[model samples]
Target: MTATFFQRLGAVVILLWLAVGLAACSNFVKGGDNRHNIPLSGGVIQGLRNMGSSPGQGMVVRIFKEESVLEVWKATGAGAYRLFKTYEICAYSGDLGPKFKEGDRQSPEGFYTITPGLMNPRSNYYLAFNTGFPNKFDRVHGRTGSDLMVHGDCSSRGCYAMTDAGIAEIYALAREAFKGGNTSFQLQIFPFRMTTANLAKHATSPHLDFWKDIKEGYDYFEMTRTPPVWDVCEKQYIFNPAGSAPLNAAGPCPATVSNPALTAKLQADEADLANKAEAARVAAEKKAAEEAALKERGAAVNNFFSGIGSGIGGIFGGQGRPEAQTGTTTTLPTPSTQRP
Candidate 1:
């Protein structure tokens, strides 16, 4: 059978991942630590160590909901990022894609910090990274939630999960970030990991309004590597400093308007996801039927084979032959006398 389009797209992602891993291998050879526990996730990883990134130095995490990918980057110098690594986040509870309100159990979408002392050394999983959500920013906005973390596990209603091996590398990086004092850095979560192309594609999403707020935060990262300031009190996105970008604006920024082309692209992508869901369902049903049929066929085949073997042995003439006597006397005395 021909490969489904979604499967092909998944293949492309795998290839891109391979390329990214190759690129990052160079970085690891030069500056990254090799002693840290490596995770099954193949993304490149590095520790900050005691080496501090200057006040201006920081990192950005972009989580893609559709792909379940988290791309991490660190500021190389002024405005450039050294693409450090990418992680596969396994969030299965499809319902919790977007954060709706407090206690939603949904992975949050917005600005957060990587606070100090955020490490969970005793995690049931292999390792974890503490994403300081609902920090001062979240609480000020009345977005109450807790224990937001990225860790390993095949299961979760709304957390970023990974295999045990995947978490080891992440843990090492988190430790490095902590020791490097990059723990006070910023984190930006979106409904899906945002890309300019992806944003344009998802432009008309039913969740666009919520995404709009997210975009504003994303724009800040695009412009500055830092996470944007969120005014929880006003319940609006603050782009410039607290005093600069007022909540009430006289007019709209030209670039703030939604782009139709981008929206169309995102719509097309969503359509593809729907297709994938359908195909997966059908494939599952087909597999179940095949397994049931195989079980019945196997029983019949085994019975036939056994019967055939027994019939063949019976026909071979050994069954009707007389058995040898267990016992007694032989006439070897006459032969012995002749020999003597």
Candidate 2:
């Protein structure tokens, strides 16, 4: 065979090989066995069943930024949620506040819902789901941002990032919840556990009012292990489990009654929180008073010593002066003897 003919054949063979390799890489990127496939661990499944929950049941997600914790709660057969798991966040971007605009790099803090459509199994980050930001409350306040996500890969730009293994289990749980006939699952993100102490500690923050607004929802959930039906009205979050009329995001809130027992409990809790805060404030004031008194005493002692030192120096200086010499005679000036 001619050398030129052999070269051309080799080039064709190389091109074919390249094409095959590209196709394989593409398939791998698209996921070989992991694409849209969520395999729950046997332990997880068994645990769920033991907790009176099944694979396909309603679920709720709660994230606390300060603690870097994500809690997954699943619905039991009794129509209440039980803590399924707590996953430590690998990373998250931004400080503790609501995301206001695009490119702010703020991971949002608020109530969000995730539907099946938000799932991105083919995510380059291993797995991900968008947190529906700019919801009713955000829109009412003219806040804007998009594609905020809880994703794997342990990196974040403006998202909550988890380890690949962590996200895999989270994704599986969420997917099963959807498959179990839930149209959506609630995801509540908070700066921290909305405890009375935390709120008081951050009482001077600019976001305090907003935090108080969200605390209502938090309190409701704590009182009853069920997700409160929440709606936005008058640019605020309104939660009512007693079935209120549909709310308009920009309109004023309508009057609604919450569960009476829960309401009472919440009121009592609030009163107790107020008492604790007041006690803390009083104690802090007392401490300040004591410290000020101590400082004042110290200053007085320092001033007294300083004055004594000055007086002693004056006495010694006077003793050392020519005027105070014990054995010296004074010379008087004579009358003028020369003409000026």
**TM-score for each model:** 0.50, 0.76
What value does the lDDT take at residue 136 in candidate 2? 83
- Return the lDDT, model 2, position 287: 100
Candidate 2 has which clashing residue pairs, if any? none
Best by TM-score: 2
Q: Against the correct fold, how does model 1 do in TM-score? A: 0.50
Model 2: residues >4 Å from true position, as ranges? 1-38, 241-245, 304-340
- Give the poorly placed runs of model 1, Cα more than 4 Å off: 1-57, 101-103, 135-142, 193-206, 223-233, 242-340
- Summarize candidate 1's per-residue lDDT along 217-281 as a digit string, tens digits: 66556545555555433444544433544333323332233445445655665566556546665
Superposed by TM-score, candidate 1 places the C-alpha of residue 223 at a distance from the truth, in angstroms, of 4.3
